[model samples]
Target: MADPSSQNPTLTTPPPPSSSLSPTPQSGTSELSPPPCSALSFLKTANRPKLRVTSEFDSDSLLFLNKVSCKLFDNLAKLKLSFQNNSQREVSQPQVSFTSKHVSVLYDIEEKNTFIKSNLDVHPRLQLRAIHNVKAQQGEVAMEANLTEPGYSLELSSPVPIGYPRATLKFPLGEISLQEKEDEEEEKQKRVLSVNGILKRQAMNGICTALYTDEELRLRYAYKDDALSFIPSISLPSNAASFAFKRRFSPSDKLSYWYNFDSNMWSAVYKRTYGKDYKFKAGYDSDVRLGWASLWVGDEAGKVKTTPMKMKVQFMLQVPQDDIKSSVLMFRVKKRWDI
Candidate 1:
């Protein structure tokens, strides 16, 4: 006979343990723990909106505060307070403005003026603007259209109730390529031509304007390259002409010149930028017989509105050749805060 254990294997082996009674490590134990309080608080603060304040101060020739302005704004609206000091009187003005995705409204307390602007969804390039003076009971409305495909624009404006309307049209003619010969040392250049037409009805009788006749017309030519730019414009009827050019010697140095043939005046300016925050400009004007110099700190490339810096300062000086004793010095300071 076999042994009793071999004959009855079920009795010798112990029964398997149930899964509910077995001991095992928990797989989600780490994930069940809560995050730190500091991390949650940081995330909440970052998503909240904050108010912004901007202050600007300007001093003119008399070394007095010519203008002082303070602005407070948030995501929806803006409020501005300004104080102006002149020779005759002092004035304090308050302004408020509200802005949305497609519409904006502005009001001036001192002047009793209201301005409204809206973008029309019916046309991608159409815009409407209106202004009203409550004290004078006068208003104006303007409509503008931008044709991007043809590089053309049309604007029409008229006074409220009864007034002559003014219209302007601007279109680009074409562009020319000026290529250099293989042996030529000069670089290739491109020139663009554009034209502008203005039609206006006379204020006296409102009958002077004709569809075929433009009250004023102008032709503009522009040539720009990596290091140089030249722009010239000539006006019809009056035959007035003006020219402007800029030359860049380096990434941070440039020289600019402008001349008006009708006025027989000219100006030349040399600008040098150091790093990202400092700029210096020196210039002379033939019309005013003045030589001027200016220095800027904080804002680079003259981008005052978009700079992240908190403070910006500008200092300017003008010396007259005819009367050195009547020289003028001016300065401006701007500061911004987020709270």
Candidate 2:
């Protein structure tokens, strides 16, 4: 045998076991110290549970993700198919797709009518209703549209509060006075002649006696040979005789009628027997009187008749005074409307 220890490879010294050590505590009556600890126990005390991070999903999570992805793919495929079908149909057949959809909300509910609300609150407000009236079909809806309608009346009787101050109108009072002037005395009282004129019987073809009685006529001094010929000046007094005219007429007579007079008519005479007033009437005879002659003519009657009868009318200052002025009073004559 050649070197049996070398051939068998026997160790000169045995190796120590792989065991860990730590500081131990002292156990004594004076100062206590703990026993030494093992490295494996220290490792057990220091090591914590490790967390595993992964990107791969679990079965439940994968199922949810698959469901969502499948739904999205199906929707996209349907949309693409629809678009392709629409494109093909559009080329083959003409179709009118009305994108302008009329909203039914813009209608009058109570009135059961539709209207266009151009400025509606939330909507675009461009709304329109049917032009003609029609019974609403099944599932028809009415909208609140027209706030007002024909024959709709509202009366506001109560007073409302206005944000304004109260207003007032105040007037100041003033005084006024008049002074009278003295007139110079006349040197002599002039002599005057009193003339009395009477108006007599008058007739007409087709006229009412009440029309004549109710009618008013005025006389003015048209012209005179001398300005102060008749009793200085015919000063119309303020008495009833100055402004009023009267006539005694029969039941079959009318006083108001026109007359054509010849010139140079004369009075009966100067009399102090002052009648109430001078009365004029249409004459009965066809004879024509003129100027001052007709003014004092007595017992006259209506003569020639005409279709549209006109009253020979004249006006004078009824109350003639130096200070009182005269003005023309107009009466509207009724005319036939047919012509």
Which candidate tops TM-score? 1
Model 2 earns a TM-score of: 0.11
Residue 68, candidate 1: alpha-carbon lDDT: 24
Q: TM-scores across all candidates?
A: 0.60, 0.11
lDDT of each: 0.65, 0.23
lDDT of 1 at 34: 53
Cα RMSD (Å) between model 2 and the true structure? Answer: 50.9
Q: Give the Å shift of residue 84 in candidate 1.
A: 4.8
RMSD of each: 20.7, 50.9
Error of 2 at 119 (Å): 49
lDDT tens readout by residue for model 2, 1-339: 011111232356854644567334355532233335656665664443221111111221121100000111212211000011121233211111111233222233345543321212333322222322233421211222222443222211111131111111111221111212223344564433222221222233211111011123222221122211111112233211121122224433223222222322222211111132223322222222212212211112221121123122222212222323442222211111111
